[model samples]
Target: MNPTPTYRDVATVGIGGPVGSGKTSLLSELVPRLREEGLEVGVIANDILTQEDANRLRERFAGVVPEDLVAGVETGACPHTGIREDPSMNLQQIDAFLAEYPGLDLVLVESGGDNLAATFNPELADYWLYVISVAEGDDIPRKRGPGVVDCDLLVINKTDLAPYVGADLEVMTRDAREVRDGPFVLTNCKAIDGIEAVHEHIVEGVLFA
Candidate 1:
């Protein structure tokens, strides 16, 4: 028999995107900002066959939150299974975090690298953000994959790399607006530029609004 879950008091947010889209980098920026707002947060990093991403986050969030609250789920296949088709593993991790940190107010679940079709199951996430890199090209939004079209918020990251990568930020913005009914933000996560907008969106979308 399974144990009762103790995480009902916590809100779960899922972050997903294609490989190299800076999903982890965004988390490195996001977690700290949420903490500053005085929220107790936990994080789960999902990866294919390795705990590398979880290890990275544990180190990144050291001292801010308990290390046990940061965990890695190894999917061993397409990243989407543990988040979309089936989320039992992710759910179990959330329960573990809550058992340790009952006051946790929010949990961020980071999916492993995936293609444009990746999306979170509503059963797993109360809210979800899909990230894509401007370096991936301005044409990305034009693709209009379910991941981009269905996410609560679409984040265009690494905006600073647009120049070297030959991506037109204006065109990306236009196409994103044309394709998505939801809000989108352009971010240079490393510099922490535009992060506040992302934080505000979460606050309004889930925390308070």
Candidate 2:
């Protein structure tokens, strides 16, 4: 028999980007800051076949967010399917989170590393963020992938590595502005720089205006 479940009055945010683009690092930074602002947050990390990302987040969040609130979803297929084409697995994990942590105000669902075409199923996310790294190349924004053009917010991470990688932030910024109607922010997630702006977007776009 299915167990009776707890329903959550929560806003879900989906985070997606190419591999090594700092999606997890951004979450690491965002979760604590959100908690500091008095929001109860849960997290789910989706991976193609491993729980590595989820384990990392569990350790990073530690006592700030209950361990049970962080979970791993193994998609067993392309990362996008679990977040976009179909999202039952993520939805179920969310329900479980809500059941365990009553009054949970937000859930950040991190999609496994995927290309720019990936996006969240609207049913699974109230707000979504797409992350890209300066290390990927200065031309990423110019590519104008759906994820970059469609997400509520776009994050250009690893600003500190820009020059080292020969990525021109100014050009990327210009291209991003040309391709999207929404806002984009530059970040060095490892240093916690620019995370406050990302948090502000979440607050204004989903939590409270």
Candidate 3:
């Protein structure tokens, strides 16, 4: 079995993937599931320029997720620094959340959804997930990026769009398994399919509950 995620004083999970791979959409689905499970979740969106994803989440989750719980980190450089190279700002945001909300159970850091090369620093996240979409094509796994091989979990989303995009879902999953030799999951956020498995994966793998 894979090693348990490194324990942090505060639980931090990084959600990362390629652009438009449905990372944010997974968050939109997960935040509510976590809340329903009574987890007080805090979110930090790492954006390349504007706080578009952060703002979108804020407006989308308005009443469901607290306003102050969401924050944006303007990733001046490539999307990696905010979560990887120097995670100082992200760590600061996490500590600030713990200070402001003592009982915060989990913090989800949504990376800007960069290329397959991006990953999270352990200093920034106890556990990390790499999201890819079926729409990106099956060869993504064959590319064997660190994001696919090293993340705590591999999430292949947008299954509903697989046919429209002409992506081979089965081959994608098989390649992921060959690359990861570990846990991988598929989902369609639009249809709310496989979301519970995602939630359970985080709860069992990251939160250890």
Best by TM-score: 1
lDDT of 1 by residue, 41-142 (tens): 999999989999999999989998779889999998899999999898998889888777888899999999999999999878999999999878789999
Each candidate: RMSD: 1.3, 2.1, 4.7
Where in model 1 is the C-alpha error above 4 Å?
Answer: 1-4
What local distance difference test score does each model get? 0.92, 0.92, 0.88
TM-score of each: 0.96, 0.95, 0.93
Per residue, candidate 3 scores C-alpha lDDT tens digits across 1-209 of: 84332225568899999889999999999999899989899999998789888999999889988899999988888998898898877887877787788888899999986888998998888888999988888799899999999998899998998889889988998898899967989999989998888888889987784
| Tens digits of per-residue lDDT for model 2, 20-43 | 999998998889889998989999
- lDDT score for residue 144 of model 1: 94
Question: Best to worst by TM-score, what's the order?
Answer: 1, 2, 3
- What is the Cα-based TM-score of model 3? 0.93
Clashing pairs in 1: none
Looking at candidate 2, the ten consecutive residues that score lowest on lDDT are 1-10
What stretches of model 2 exceed 4 Å from their correct place? Answer: 1-8
